[model samples]
Target: MWISTSFFMMLHIPLRTETTSLMSSGKTLRKGVRKMKREILYPELTTLYGDGGNMLLLKQCCNDAVFRETGLEEVPWFVSEDVDFICIGSMSEPKQLLVREKLKPYKERIRELIEKGTVFLVTGNAMELFGQYIEDRKERMEMLGIFDYHAQRNLDKRLNYIVLAQYEKLPVVGVKSQFSQIHGLDNHHFLKMVKGLGDNEGSEFEGIHYRNFFGTYCLGPLLVYNPQFTKHLLELCGQKGEIVFEKELEEAYYERLRKYRHPDSPVVLGHGFI
Candidate 1:
């Protein structure tokens, strides 16, 4: 019942450009349109588990988004300039601590931005960097404390599962592979799990949501797996554009959903890593 990250990456759909409308406040973008500025934080470390595809798909959807791959040593674009969207993807457990240390100084800035409704997409364990602390058997590391939650890590075992969750009527489907489970997340959940373990083994809610910030442990190109959710995300970014290969993406989504929802599907609990 286990699926490799490459299984999601090898969609085999041909990429093609389509005309898209990027609108905000009843205004349509025209010639010389100001491009949407986006930042991918620390791509060198955060691009784990094929998460790089999330930004690629996002760029294709936005059409004219100016993307900055911010390195670990460079200052983040969101710190000084107005950025339309910021994304941080999955990384190794050790890298999470490094990222936390790098962003610790900007904790207040990040909180202000989150409160201001800046769009943020944090996937996989990268979301843990925003929590109060991360604890494993060996040691405890303080995180950004942007949120009130904490995470417990068990390096000996990995939790892997196919998730089917709902975020505002949209069926979100993705895979979660992590060595940690979040704790102390209250009502600020991003998705309600329909058929998967969430936050932790005992919780039915998944991810963290505050204003426009979306943090989830799910990985393997989340934006690509859930086209509906991606469209919703773009709308939050002040974009209502046609997704490249939209038809193909939707078809694939339905197929995956159907299989997961099937009564005899092996991906259900007791079969897949729950």
Candidate 2:
């Protein structure tokens, strides 16, 4: 089930029956299953972008797979630990700087984890900051320097739209909005390009991939349009056990995809960022 709020443009998505049942059953049988821990680090100081819906989507996805389907326990680690997957969402420039300061201590640890093949899903400015630096004219700050790139903010225009692609056999959908131009990237590969922000300037640099890290500028409540990507992510997190998909879940997900794919869908419109 899902509900929408016009004021915040937020959508409330409920856990499917199979997911709820699995989580309930898994809690009862926690003794035998291997657990997976995923972390979502939100910088409180940063102004959230992308409808602020990605975390909810991620939680629901993980709950369905690890907690609901396979009955595997899951945990959230924010301060830095052995995280199987780490997601960094979009935030405003000032807020991003604050987060950069907060994350300074964990830079080495984050690098280590990524080298071990841990998945990192960095969206919006989060992806931009992983590069060398971000210059806002008034202030210039260094980022985590995880990826081999640089981001320079542009006040001229903001790009916003829905994105379509396939990565590692999983279909994905997302929205893009940023004024930053990325450069200094030496080696990287793109998974796919469909509608919005393809490679770079709709030509190249659409998406970036290095090892297990996936970075994109897409925002449009990304996960809601890309359940297949979520499934693959969970599989990478070690929840590949056999399971049956409930009809309700499938129906809900596909319906969302259809709606978003429409040329005139409300969610597909620009939110003043373009």
Candidate 3:
């Protein structure tokens, strides 16, 4: 039986709050899971900073996946059909506005899918589209309002960081490169910052994790850099196959983790403009 979306909201327990809790709640796929045919939706205009690699990772992991791509003018496949996963990458600041406008019409459907536990991975600034608004020195642009958060954008300055965060027992490492910082996120954060700035300079949390929807500023090659997390994701999608390059990916992940753990490693905050 499918769980009701309002029930989860009323309880205030996000589906992917923590690994242990998630497992205990029986929301995750169990051990010895079998492969299932997955339909993946890839929407257009969110490709930037090599974030498109997220989709490639999914395709590589799920051999029986059926992939669909939609342009800005075209209606997304998920609007009419049920999709197992939806992945969107980073895009330019101008493109963000366009994409937001294009997706505004389907905001309710997106929210419903997220509540139903359809896996969604929105990386980099693409995540901001689901928020309340994006404000800059020039003007304020309204967003989807699926979440209460808002973003502050500064076109002049860019913030760069190599973040090391913990998600339950897993170590998550990624690059955060953005001209904007998110605000108003509290309970539904995706990662706990162990050594880096999050959402903004004052915040300790990074990204959004509501139900199976994962929205983050961590840009580029996220899946390739974290094999364990990828494996977990495959399991979440009902696949329990071997990762394409498990050994090599784990080596790279641990090496990066080692470097990130060092005291001297830098989390560069360029200009510190919010």
Candidate 4:
């Protein structure tokens, strides 16, 4: 039901509709400069599965965006300054704990930022931070507890799904493949899962969407597969920017979505002890 910039996203990428302008290095601009600020957390470790493209997508989508980033030891500037967007992408399980610990000190600040309209896109394992805790067998890992969900790592069965959901009038699509599943937001969900598992296979619902917080397990460089969603983000921030390589991006997105929509598409599921 949803198609606009999305029709272009389905086209497939030799164009890298996702990897456009990438900005970083804590560069400060003029005080009166009205550029949108976007911050990425621990890119070195969390850029797995091409999720780094999300940052590039944002940089290009928001031409005035002054992109900044933080390392594991550095405090995120969003804690003290205004930022339009904050991104935390995919990382391994061990690194997840490390990042969680680094973020623990900023709980109150994160809460405040959420209230003030700072959008956060926490994808893959990074979403564990927003939950109350994550359990791997008998061991338990505490999380930020911003949302009521509790994540449980599936040591035996990792799930991989081709996600298709509806966001307003747009038909949202992405890939959801992970070892941990979250539960708790039965009533409040990101979208109605039309196909494939959402938070978990048992749940028909997927993700959690609040004022500006968008947490999901979907990968496939979500923004790359869904450019319309990126545009929606700009609108949510009250900002405007143009999509780079629209024609090529559209073609790439179409090619990729075609493969995904195929009934006999190839599946990539890993078997690991994590």
Top candidate, metric lDDT:
1
lDDT of each residue in 1-274, candidate 4, tens digit only? 2234453454332221222132323455567977667788888788776677777666656655666777777878787789888999999888988898889999989988988878999888888888899998779988999889999897677687777777667667677668888878765578777676778768877888888898888776788777777778778877755576555556666776676567776444443211
Error of 2 at 141 (Å): 2.5
As a TM-score, model 4 comes out at 0.83
Question: What is the C-alpha local distance difference test score of candidate 1?
Answer: 0.81
If scored against the real structure, what TM-score would every candidate get?
Answer: 0.87, 0.73, 0.82, 0.83
Q: Candidate 3, residues 77-148: lDDT per residue as tens digits?
A: 788877777878888788887888778788899989889998888888888899999999989999999999
lDDT of each: 0.81, 0.59, 0.74, 0.74
Q: Which pairs clash in model 1? A: none
User: What stretches of model 1 exceed 4 Å from their correct place?
Assistant: 1-33, 268-274
Q: How accurate is candidate 3 locally (lDDT)?
A: 0.74
lDDT of 3 at 133: 95
Question: Please, what are the lDDT tens digits per residue for candidate 2 over residues 62-177?
Answer: 54333121111222253445657777777777677767776777787777887888887777778876788877666667888877777767667765666665665655665677
On residues 199-269, what C-alpha lDDT tens digit does candidate 1 reach at each position? Answer: 99999999998999999987657988888888999999988967876887888788888988887765433
Root-mean-square deviation (CA) per prediction? 5.3, 6.5, 11.6, 6.1
**Among these predicted structures, which one has the highest TM-score?**
1
